[model samples]
Target: MKTEFTDIAVIGGGPAGLAAALEAKRAGVKRVVVLERDVELGGILRQCIHDGFGIHRFKKRMSGNEYAQAFIDETEKSDIKAYADTTALELTADRKIYACNSRDGMLEIRAGAVIMTTGCRERTASQALIYGERPAGALTAGAVQRYINIDGYLPGKRAVVLGSGDIGLIMARRMTLEGIEVEGVYEVMSSPGGLTRNIVQCLDDYGIPLHLSATVTKIEGRDRVRAVTVAKTDGSRRPIAGTERVVECDLLVLAVGLIPENELLIKAGAEIDPRTKGAVLNDRFETSLSGIFAAGNAAAVFDLVDYVSVSGEIAARGAVEFLRENTSDKNTENASGGADGYVPVIAGENINFVIPQRVRKGAARDLAFFMRVKTSAPRAELRCLCDGAVAEKKVCRYIAPPEMLSMTPCCAAEREIKIDAVNE
Candidate 1:
């Protein structure tokens, strides 16, 4: 067993971890270490060859690999140390990281602060309740992507995508480009689950039909996926009795949903938000456990990678602040105020949920509140209330559950903030 110490330890060397490690180093942290399970620094981004990333951060459209490479280059130039092929087995609430790698063997890292950026995983066939025989052709969109793009093997010649998520939509286009036929994209919701731009660029541009309010209820085949029964779903998202149709395809690619990868965070005693399935955080991205922070998809499933990197920076800043404060005064108490001074952020009508569920009055700097809507609205009004008084109000031309909305409102001291969205 090897023991190491650092000012900050970042778990997962994807975009979030890379960004956080770099930010911590830039913040004058004496030692910053990033642990990655993969052999390389880039995570899933390495396999994503499609363009449309870096629009918000770089102000230019780039491929996923390109976006990740840019960050990798920056990290290589920085003082932060990266441990590739290292998997974190456990995380303690007190900032101890137990990790293992072929080269390092079992290792224990003690850090002043820790940041979790484990990202997210796709919902599989079983999780989606798609009654099916365990067949080789049934796979998630992400898995197919890795198989096709990374491994250079086509999963199937013909495919039926079960969800209209961004990954499913992109794979529909990717498979078509790779000379595979994409039958159609079936979505359970009336509205598409992906961004409007993806719906246009990936599906509409590729001439692939999107079956809204529809889902695949059953799969048929023993060796491989021979066919699937897709049915129209009613308001309850239940398959209608008489609206079943069979789609014959070799592949059943599921793009159901994404769940944040937070097993280690949960095991470490961090409270999770039921809505986001991520850690409950404050304005600074600090989790329920002091000195522990979460960012990127590990915090919430962000729509854009730009925001993912931003979240890492936020968590790094919080960790740096925590380390500095604790080192300055060993007996200093947690600056986060009491329950009364912590303002609860409520999700009002039509709002799915908001990040940073609570705000410590007068303890936070200018912060952006990220949230998603419950439904689609052509025109909507977003209101931020502080103690029943309107703190900020903005009119948005369009809002949807797929696209995350971010707003930075001036928060008043010692007041509860409520966020709500409604059709205008």
Candidate 2:
């Protein structure tokens, strides 16, 4: 066993972890380290060769690998230390981390603060409940992506995608580019789950059909996927009895959903949010556990990678503030406690959920709230209420679940804040 100490220890080396580690180091943290389970610093980005990333942050379209490379380059130039091929096995509420790798058999790290950016995992065939045989060709869109993009091998010739998520849409186009026939994309919801831009570029431009309010109820084949039975669904998303159709294909690619990787956070005694399936966090991105913060997909799945990076930076700033306050005996104001006051931020009407479910008053001059809508709205009014009074209001031309809404409002001296969205 090896013992180490640092000001901050970040788990996971994906975009969120990379960005958080870099930001923490830049924020004057004496010692910062990032632990990545993968062999390389870049996580899933290495497999995402398609362009469309960095549109918000870099102001130019770049490939996922290129976007991750930019951050990797910055991290390498900074004072931050990153350990690749290291898996974080345990995290404690007191900012202790247990991790291991082949090179470092076991590591026990004690840090002033800890940041979790473990990212997310895609929903698989069994999880999605696609009743069928466990065939070799049945794989998630992300798996197929890794197979084709990273490993440079085609998984199948003909495929039937069971979800209309961004990854699925992108893979639909990717498979098409590779001369693989994408029979069609089916979504249980009436509306597409991905961004409109992806629907246009990946499906519309490629002449691929998108079946809405439909799903793959069953898969067939013993050795390899031979076909899938897709059916139209009712309002409850249950497949209708007489609307079943068989689509013959070698591969069944599932793009159903993503689940945040928060086992370590849970082990660390952090409160989990039921809606987001992440962590219940304060305005400073600090989790329920003291000195532990979560960001990016580990906090909640963001529609854009740019937003993921933003969350990481926020968590980094929070960690820096925490370390600065605790390191000095003179700074006795415990920001994690109720000395500054905390206001619960409730999600109301048309909003699925909001990050930073609670806000610590005086933590920041301006607090940013990120949320996703439950349904599409052509015109809507967003309101941030403090103590039943409208603190901020904004009118939007359109809002959808696929695009996360970010609003930064000046902090008010109120103890309660509620964010609401309604069709106008």
Native-referenced Cα lDDT, model 1: 0.90
RMSD of 1: 1.8
**Against the hidden true structure, what lDDT does model 2 obtain?**
0.89
Q: Pick the candidate with the highest lDDT.
A: 1
In model 2, the Cα lDDT at residue 411 comes to 62
**Model 1 spans > 4 angstroms off:** 330-334, 337-341
Residue 12 error, candidate 2, Å: 1.3
How many clashes in candidate 2?
0
- Looking at candidate 2, the ten consecutive residues that score lowest on lDDT are 331-340
Q: Which sections of candidate 2 miss by over 4 Å?
A: 331-334, 338-340, 362-364
